[model samples]
Target: MQFNPVTFAIPVFVALIVAELLWARRRQPRAYESRDTATSLAIGLGSTVAGGLTAAAVLAMLVWAHSATPLSIGWAWWAWPLCFVLDDLAYYTFHRSAHRVRWFWASHVNHHSSQHYNLSTALRQSWTGFFAASFIFRLPLAFAGFEPGMILACGGFNLIYQFWIHTESIKRMPHWFEAVMNTPSHHRVHHAVNARYLDRNYAGTFIIWDKLFGTFAAEDDADQIRYGIVHQIGSFNPLKVVFHEWLAIARDVWRAPWRHKLSYLWREPGWSHDGSRETSDMIRRRWNAAATDQKD
Candidate 1:
């Protein structure tokens, strides 16, 4: 039997979420809404269902790729650490692409749809992520001779590490930890829809990737972080939240001219055929300009 770390972590995840819920009720009742929490849990259930349905095929592909590859970097003691780092790098690449590319963003947008930042919000995952082929990002590890099981285990640990960061309950961490790891503070900035925070802090387990790639932005105390996507979804219905962006993408691509259809699918979330929509870069520039004007 294959060991599934995420499945084993489910009880721990539930316990922590319950603890957070109790903490929020006592300290910050406004941090969570009943409907939003239910929606998040529903979406999470759907993601697990979708993931299980696709697991066989995904594993098959990885196995085939691993067999075909010439190199066999076996399960040495050091290989585990190496796999963890490489898998995290793969996550950073896929995650950044999910934000930048519309097709992937259609699946990913649901994860960011919740306005409330809580432990439940981490469970609000994408039902269509399997279809989005985001797993392809980690395929290189398999082809490079890393065992698929090791890669998957590292990926699970990466996700488990991220779950705690979704909460607003914990504030900043120690300076050394904050500097090196993806703490709650850094992740809050990532989830913020604020123009300045948009598309920044794309890290998985380590903060070093964001700093090295010029995507790191410190959380600002002056500007409050607003959670959710740029255009918020009004409904708490899981179905609507899961497929809204996909529907929007379909609509945009259907109406777009032939020459621009590919761009509509591949470009950033806010990109449009005309200059009417604003990408994250454009939004940030406008925000910066307005700030400059205010100072002047």
Candidate 2:
């Protein structure tokens, strides 16, 4: 059986969420909305169930891939840390692709749907990740000789490390820690719908990956951060939150010309056949241009 640290951390996750709720009450009431929290929890539960159903198949594939490879890193103590760091890098790659590629983004967008950023919002996971083939990202580790179980355990720890950072409770960490790790401040920029912050800070555990890869964007206190997608679904319905993007993709593909149909599935989010919509990059360009004009 694949060892998943997230399974053991469920109780701790609950306690921390409750503590965050109380803190929100005393500090930031808007941080926790009733319906939004319920929807996020419901989606998270479904995502867990979805992942459970697919876990065995994913592990089996990883094992098969590992068997095909001649290299074996084995279960050495050093392998554990090495596997974790590599797994985090894999997450960074998957995450960056998930934003840049619409098919992957459809599965990832649910995690960013909530307008609120709190511990509970961290629970907002995607139910269709398996359908989107996100597990493909970790397959490289299997091919590289890391054991499938070790890769999973490391990925679980990565998830756990990310949970607390999805909040407004703590503004920033120590300068050194913030520079090295993915903190609330950095992650907030990731989740923000602000044009300046769009498609940035995709680090899973270590902020170093984003820093190295040039995807890092620091949080600016002067500009208020608005959470959620560019086109807000404007609903608390969990099913809508989970399937809206997929449905949109289907509709866009069906309606587009045959030559452009596949583009709808693979192109960046907000791409349009007729230049009718704006992707994050387009939005950022416009914002920058307007700012430059105003300064002139």
Candidate 3:
């Protein structure tokens, strides 16, 4: 029998909950001003647990379906290390696509909802992920002759590696290790909303994917990172978290042309007007400028 992820992963779950509680206690003063941070977290966590377990059940079915046959296409259990890398390649594609599509981004936007970045924030995964991230793309792996169990296991493996990097500690890895794999340093950049840090470094285990694909960006010490999106939802409410961007998407779709409507679902999140009106950067700045001008 293979190692059960729920069994092995218990330590991670327990540790995160304990650590986040301690962190919450320490930051109670700041959290009050942030207004109901605990409430948002409670709802968000419930949704995340429900959503994650639901997804796991769905993934398990695929694994069981392809496990018995002599027709498994992926490498053997011994060769799963390579399959891990392949799994990450597909992950990168799914991630990039998720950001590109508004509907997909709606489910994913929750992970980035927090203005604060920490382990708990990482666990603040969206519940509606099933609607956006189906097993459609990964099915290709099954068809390519790879065993579903191997592929699904690799998916879990990728997610496990990705979890610890959600910390503020462990700033960097060794020079050699940092050169190849995704370190916390790279992940910190991914969480930043700073103009330069918006969408860089999407690799799970290998930084090589980002380097090869031109999405890599080195972290800077001089400029402190401001975490979260340009437009902060400022709530831990799971319903709001999952539907906030979706609401924005619906508004954009209402007035948009047929071509624009379709593109909003298929193109990048900030894509607008055939590159005519404004960039996401420009829109954020303009909104801020207008707010400032009103204040003055």
Candidate 4:
């Protein structure tokens, strides 16, 4: 077993969740729904098992890729920060694709299934990420000469950084900090199902990626945020929460015409061959148009 920061942070993660639970009881009772919290924790546990099962193969591939590289970052201290930033960029790419691309979204949707925004929602990780081949997103760093272990460690820290931002408890960070880093405010926008927020704020550690890529949507204090997917999966059952999107994708692929079959797999969620459903772009357009009409 390698030195995974996430594993070491597990105790602290539990402590914070307990602290948040106590806070929620007094400040916002609705923030901690018992069933939702349990489901999220179970899914998170299953994800760890799933990741453990596939870690060896994934690490072997990264090691091979790194060995083949002409350049080697080797164990330089300066390399850690560079690797961490690059890894975060890779995460931003993966996180954005996990929303824009249905195949990836099928694996990532469980994280956003909970309607409540709390520490527990952070634990709703994906059990199918390895199967989704999400590790490919970070393979570029390995090929670019960073050690596989360093890349994985940086990724662990990135995951840890994101866990605390998954709450409604913190409204906003300072303006300067909010501008650069991924805060609870920025993350809340990412989790929001609102028309304006859909497919926005994909940064994992730094918010700069979203700003640079035009995917940034600030958390609007005036407009109440609604969490979860556009089409709600109204079940707290861990199995349903984790696999519903995947099952839907399978059903869609099976039912679609041969010509459009692949589209169902790769297209953004809500995409239908006959235009029966709406993608985020389509939903946003509709919402914008309605807003325009009401103003007129």
Give one digit per residue, the lDDT tens place, for model 4 in 1-296.
67789988989999999999999899999998898899989998998898888889889989999988898989999999999999999999999899988999999999999899998788888899988999999899999999999999999999999999999899988999998999999999999999999999999999999999999998888899999889898898899999998899889889988999999888888899999899999999999999999999
For model 1 the local lDDT of residue 214 reads: 91
* TM-score-best of 2 and 3: 2
Per-model clash counts, in order, read 0, 0, 4, 0
Worst 10 residues of 2 by lDDT: 1-10
Report the candidate with higher TM-score, 1 versus 3.
1
Overall local distance difference test of candidate 1: 0.91
Give lDDT tens digits, candidate 1, residues 129-235. Answer: 88888889989999999998888888889999999999888888999999999999999999999999999988999989999999999999899999999988999
RMSD of each: 0.9, 0.7, 5.5, 0.8
Q: After superposition, how far is residue 245 of candidate 1 from its true place, in Å?
A: 1.0
TM-score result, candidate 2? 0.99
What are the lDDT scores of the predictions, listed in order? 0.91, 0.93, 0.70, 0.92
Q: Which whole-number lDDT from 0 to 100 does residue 18 have in model 1?
A: 92
Error of 1 at 296 (Å): 1.6
Q: Order the candidates by TM-score, highest first.
A: 2, 4, 1, 3
